[model samples]
Target: MGLSMFALSRRSDARFAPARSSAELPPSFLGSGIRVRGVLEIEGELTIQGFVAGRIAALKLIIAPGGRVEGDIVAREVVVSGNLNGRIFAPNVTVEETAHIDGRIFHNTITVARGAHFDGRMPWRPVNFFETLDQLPETQP
Candidate 1:
């Protein structure tokens, strides 16, 4: 996976702690009525309140309560409060109570709140795995 120059410039330490909090960065938002496809790569935070069907890479990713996503996700942190039907690759993952997930989650630390419906596998990876994850593996589904 290759990152944009901007993303490389903003790269953080191994722990994913940037100079500023994710909240401090202006997020890219997708409205509830919108739909998108293809690859999306962001250096900062991304909030999805719509429907997306593709791969996403970001520093932080948030799926709003009514959002829907289908594909692979790579981020430093991920918070899902909606629907997902694919894989998540992150160091820190939070499955909110309103979330519905299927597929797999690969993380160093994770939290799945009560009321969240998830029917998949959660694989634990060392923190260094994320720090050096330059490409996604083509593994078992």
Candidate 2:
């Protein structure tokens, strides 16, 4: 009877355990020597050190120094320290000093370092607007 009770308590504890956030999950990495041209989707975090020419959807994305991307990115948060010639649709964005961007950024909150080279428009959106990224208009405002 004691063993049964202990098992039940253990199960309860497991059920009530806090869920892990995207930052706490293991990150996926794309090496510097790699190149991909397709849609990339990640549930947790993704770090890129290579070249990608397609759409990327992730919970969090980091473009490391020397990385390059040419396409659209939709994420909850994004950090760029490389080169990008595409559009970004994220609620939170950070452009490091080493970043060079030539496209549009749609964000609710954004931070660009002093040395970052950016030649594009940064459109501000409400937090609720990002809740439905799939419904984004095809034309840029």
- Could you tell me how far off, in angstroms, the CA of residue 141 lies in candidate 1 after the best superposition? 15
**Candidate 2 all-Cα RMSD:** 8.5
Query: What digit string (tens of lDDT, one per residue) describes model 2 on residues 1-141?
Result: 998986556334422222224657888999999999999988788899999999998878899999999999988788999999999988789999999999999987889999999999999988666666767774222
Off by over 4 Å in 2: 1-20, 137-141
Off by over 4 Å in 1: 1-13, 16-24, 137-141
Q: After superposition, how far is residue 26 of candidate 2 from its true place, in Å?
A: 1.9
Error of 2 at 102 (Å): 0.6
Model 2 Cα shift for residue 82 (angstroms): 0.4
RMSD for each of the candidates: 4.7, 8.5
- Candidate 1 lDDT, 70-130, residue by residue in tens: 9988888899999999999888899999999999999988999999999999999987777
lDDT of each: 0.85, 0.84
Position 3, candidate 2: lDDT: 85
Compare the candidates by lDDT and give the number of the best one: 1
Which consecutive 10 residues in model 1 have the weakest lDDT in total? 12-21
